[model samples]
Every structure is written in C-alpha cells, then in structure tokens.
Target: MPNDKGRRRRFGSVRKLPSGRFQARYRGPDGLMRTADNTFATQTDADRWLVKQEAKILDGDWTNPDVKIAFGDFAEDWFKDRDYAATTRERNAVVLNRFILPTFSDLPLREITTPQVRRWRTDLIEAGVGAASVAKAYQVLRAILHTAVDDGLIERNPCRIKGAGSVTHTERPFLSVPEVYRLADAVPPHCRALILLAAFCALRFGELAALQRHDIDLEAHTVSVRRAYAETRAEGLIVKAPKSAAGVRTVAFPASLAEELAHHLAEYADAGRTGLVFVGARGGVMRRNNFRRIWLRALAATGLGDVHFHDLRHTGNTLAATGGASTRELMHRMGHSSVRAALIYQHLVNGRDHVIADYVDGQIRKVKRPPHGPSGT
Candidate 1:
C-alpha cells in the first residue's frame, strides 16, 4: 500500500486514496477539519490545490468547505434569529420568499458572487419589480450575507451593486393648518379628534390607534405614548411597546384643543382609563383596513383626496420645524431614533431660504452702517 500519508505540504496534508487519487485536507478557521470537494488525479494536483488554499488563508479569504449550507437554510436561521417588530418581520419574510429565494434558494452561501448579485438586481428591475421593492429586497439580501460573513459561513459578502439598496421616495404632500382642520371636520364626529391628534401631536397612525383614555392628561396638556399597535397576520392588532426607546415619550398638545380633547374623552372615549381613546363605530379597536373607507370619504369631502393620512404627521413636523425647532427637538418630538428622519422633516420648514438670505443681508448692512450720534457721524 502506498504510504497513505503520502506527503506533508507546508499548509495541510495530502494522502493517496485507495483508488490512486490524492486527497487534500486542512484545518479551517473554525478549528474544524475540512476536505476538498473532489480528489485530485495526482499528488501534484493536490499540492497545487493546497497551495492555492494556503494563499487564500493567508489573504484572509478562505472559506471552510464544511460550511456547505444552502442560502435557503441560512436564510431560515437568519429570519429565526431576527428580533425585529412583528410588522418588520412579516415584511422581511414576504420579501425573502418573493424576491430572494427564487434567485438563490439552492446556491451555497459561499458560491454567491458579486456579479451574480448584480445580475439578480438587474433582472429584478427588468422583471418590473418596483424600485422601492428591489431596494428593500436588496437590503435584506445584503444584510443576510453580511451576517453570513460575520458567522464565517462565507469568506465575503458578494452584494456589491453600488446604490442598489437605496430608493428615492417621491415628495410627500403636506397639509396646511387649515387643511388639517378641514379634513378633521370632513371625517365622522368620532374620528375628528383622531385626525387632529395625528396632525397636531405628530403621532403615527399606530401610536394614535394604540392610545388609551388614561394616556391623555388634559390638565397637563400632554399625551403619553406608552405603546403602539401593529397589524400582523400572526397576531391581529398586536399591541407592543414603542418602536424605539425614544418613541416612548410624552408629547404635549396645544391647549387650544383641550376643550376638543375633553369633549372627546367624555363623549367618544370608552369609560375605563384603559379603554380605547379612539375606536370604531361599534367601540372596537380601530384598524386601518376598516378606517380606509372613512378616510377616503373624508378625502373626497375635503377636496384634498390626494393627501395621504400619514401626511398629517408630516404637516405637523413641518409646522414644528418652521416654529424654529432644532434638530434635537425635532428628533424628540417626532420620536425618531435617528437624526436622518428628523433632518428630512426639518428640511420642510418653509421660508428657510428667505430667512437665510435676510440673515446674510442683515450681516452686510451691519458691517456697512454703524450706530452714530445725532450728528450723522
């Protein structure tokens, strides 16, 4: 029998098989023994393969052959490990099943290439997937691959399509103060306070929907955002804590609406402190699907049909910005966890260009003219 330990290479060991083929094996980064996919025809071929693997290891790009996990298998584990909100989890699952799996389901995590990622993205756009959808799906895939890299399942993430993960959103419509009240009036009597609170308090629809009678303190002129509602197939109308730590804040409403709020509490609000602040016609939890009917009717009646209900929050944030709210203040008031969203809303402050121009003119005038005595000096 040939000395089965045929040769000792610099990086790993090569052994001659019973069938006269040479096999290469090495210890991987994960401290596990790994073997090449196929036996080499000769000892030189096995040594050459080991040399290449050693070079890759030195360059920090070697992947363990034992990590033959398929993309679908890794993705299943990835999804299970995610601790995102219910709605976010649902959205990710939908995107994975719809867009990602069809392209890379059976492919090994290590076999995914950057060129393949680029082509997949191109194919998605050509197949008429919306730009936003493509961006979202690309983000999901990139995130999964990044985790795979961190987990040492792959040498590197192959998601290198530049700007493929960004989506440009169209400018959203914002309502004027009068337009907010007009829409509020157009909605049903019970829903008027809901609309006004959404606009003035700068509250998200879920936050408003999750409100309870005790969360509002008319005397304090503040509303406490302790929780939010999310719609999910797994759990209908799941009530959960705020989206972020900053989301759990007490926001004040102007005292101008105190009367409206008190009246709403006495008339429309349910009896208990924990009772729903806003509810359906039958005094049940408010759902967007059911509320869309009322919302569409109010839109038609207000002649502001094109406006999205979420735009009310935009209008509120814009008003706050124009009122000279700082970046930090905007983040707090908007319950934003990042400065990005706060800055986006802050840019909507009208007349800022004129304000800047006037400021520059004032500086020039101050330099040109100095205060003088009555002698006109």
Candidate 2:
C-alpha cells in the first residue's frame, strides 16, 4: 500500500488535537464529510460520539448538525406555513415584532436555551410591559419553539416556564338590568337596540356590526350569527366566519325585544332586507373608532365608568345562569366552545340557590296545607 497513514477511515476517524483533546470526523451518507459539534478529552470518548452518529444514520434519524437556521427566518416560515385568520395573523405579527423576534432573531434555533427565555420574560415585565401582553408574547414564543422541536430542528423546547403562557382573568364589573337600560337610553337613538341586543342576546360587537335585516327574525325573536366583521391593519375591515364553530349559531332573544327591533328597522336601518341592520352615521360599516366616541359619551352620561361593550355579554351570561341555565344551556346561549368558560357563569348561579330553596318551600307548603273544607286529612 502507498502511504495508508494519511488516508481517512471508512466510517469515522479520531485524531488528537493540538490542545491534547480528541476530535472526531465522519463521512455522512450525503457523501460530505462532517465533524462533531463538540470536542472530547480522549480518543475513546470521540469514538463513542462517532459511533452514536453512525447509529443515528443507520436508524434513519440523522439530522444535519450544521443546519443553523436563524430563529427569525424559521419563525417567519412557520407563520406562513399555516392558514390563520386575518385577525389572528395580525395579532401574531404584532407579538412577534414587538416582543419575540427582537430578542431571538439572530440566534440559531438550536442555540436558544431556557435561561434566555426566562430572562426575556423577566426583562419584558421589568420594562413595564402589561401582563396580558407578556402572556401573549410568551404564548407565541412557546408555540414557535414547539414547532421547532417538532421539526427536529431542536431537541427540546426552551420555553419551559410553567404557566407563563396563561394569565389570570381578573373579574370585571358587569351591568345590572337597570344599568343596561340606562346605558341604552344614554346612547344615540339608532344604537339603543344595539346595546339591548348586545346585553341580552350576548352578541359580540363584530356580530352586531355584521348583522343584516335578514339575520333577525322579529316574529321568532331569533338572531342568526352567520358571519362576523374583523378590522385588520393589512386588509381593513373584512367579513369572515365566526371565531369558532360554536359561534355560528342562531340564538333566540326574549320576545320583549320585538318592539325595539321593529322600531330600529323602521327608523335608522337600511331599507332592503339584505341591508345592514346597524351602520355608522355615514351609512357604511361600523368602525370601532367611530363608534367608541359615542360609546364613551354614553358611558359617562349613564355613570357606567368605562364599562367595555363585552361586559354586556358577561352580564347576559350571568343573567342566564340566575335564570337556571344549565352548563350546556349556557354554553349554547353564549356560544362558548368550552365547558370551562360556561362553568364560570355557572358559578354565578350560587346566589340563585336561595331563590330556588324559597320556591321549593312554597311548593311544599302548597302540598302540605290542610284540606279546603274543614282541615280533613
């Protein structure tokens, strides 16, 4: 043989480095020579590492050690690979740009450690970022890293901070029946029905904005939630499906609202059956910025003190619970996709139990009362 000393081995080779540590190199199945990402202190340890790489290749699980995709590039591709709603995409974009990508953009996916994620969250909170914003940012970061793990780009997710993605929901004040009527009376004449329906029917603002005359059945006192409106920065206001399958429901309203509905239809509503039931003063789509001014004024006039429009839905759910709506019934009425949310309203039913007990006592007295004639048995 002609100088076999300088030739490389068939599977792998180990050599003592000038630093006295051993390095391993192997010929990959891709026909390219590759080196271990780490150095070993002895030749035996280096041989063991190369043997593991050979085992990975033979088992069809070998991933390129040198695949150094940057986090921002992978995250962009991950976001694009999915078909998300316009609103969801917009929110994710905001979270990524404002919180996540700035910290981890240049770091390679495999190099992101759990310590770095914890530090990032701590920095955001220390910088006075709101808890909700931090939670959303953490959730998005965890999701992106989760996908990276699934793609075999990283061994484990670095987002191991327990419950960091979830935020505690602080209970907000809801309108009472009188408060609801007062707020309704305070708003503009055209929006009175909107307030009532939002409070009683538990309609979302988007659902109310997307309503057409045909969506309401005055005779049946039902509102069909077929579609909803979402304002995205990328596409302005767009009509899309409801947020969930449970949202695409037809909910019955109290027959008492019939007069209010009829009055709104006759006065300020668009003419045709297909025409919008509620519109801005310009007779176009209802934009939040345009409507919020009037809403705040009405809140001030009624002394509601900055009650969000969604609080009306909360009030409605509470009312339904007090009216003896079961968990399933509450879920259906509120279009809640999960029992967990419906259960929160169900907890509000505790105070109604006193009324239930009094009613039962009256029924028992009616049954146990003496005979009508002469106190006969």
Q: Which number leads on lDDT? A: 1
lDDT of each: 0.80, 0.79
Tell me the deviation in Å of residue 236 in model 1. Answer: 1.2
lDDT tens digits, residue span 1-377, model 2: 21312236567987776777777889888889998888997677877888888898897777786789999999999989868889999998999998999999999998999999999999999999999999999999999999988887887899999989999988977777668877877888888889988887778999999999999998866788888999988999999998877777666676556677887888778989888999999899887778899999998888779689899988777766766766666676677766444443353355332333233223324434332121211
Write candidate 1's Cα lDDT for 1-377 as tens digits: 34876765567889988898989988877887778989999888988988888887888877667558999999999999999999999989999999999999999998999999999999999999999999999999999999998877887799988898999999998887667767877888889889878877789999998999999988867788889989998878889988887787766675556677787887788889899899988888888888999999998887895888889889777766766666666676678876444443344355342242233233324434332222322
lDDT of 1: 0.80
Output the TM-score of candidate 2. 0.80
RMSD of each: 11.1, 9.6
Which is the leading candidate under TM-score? Answer: 2
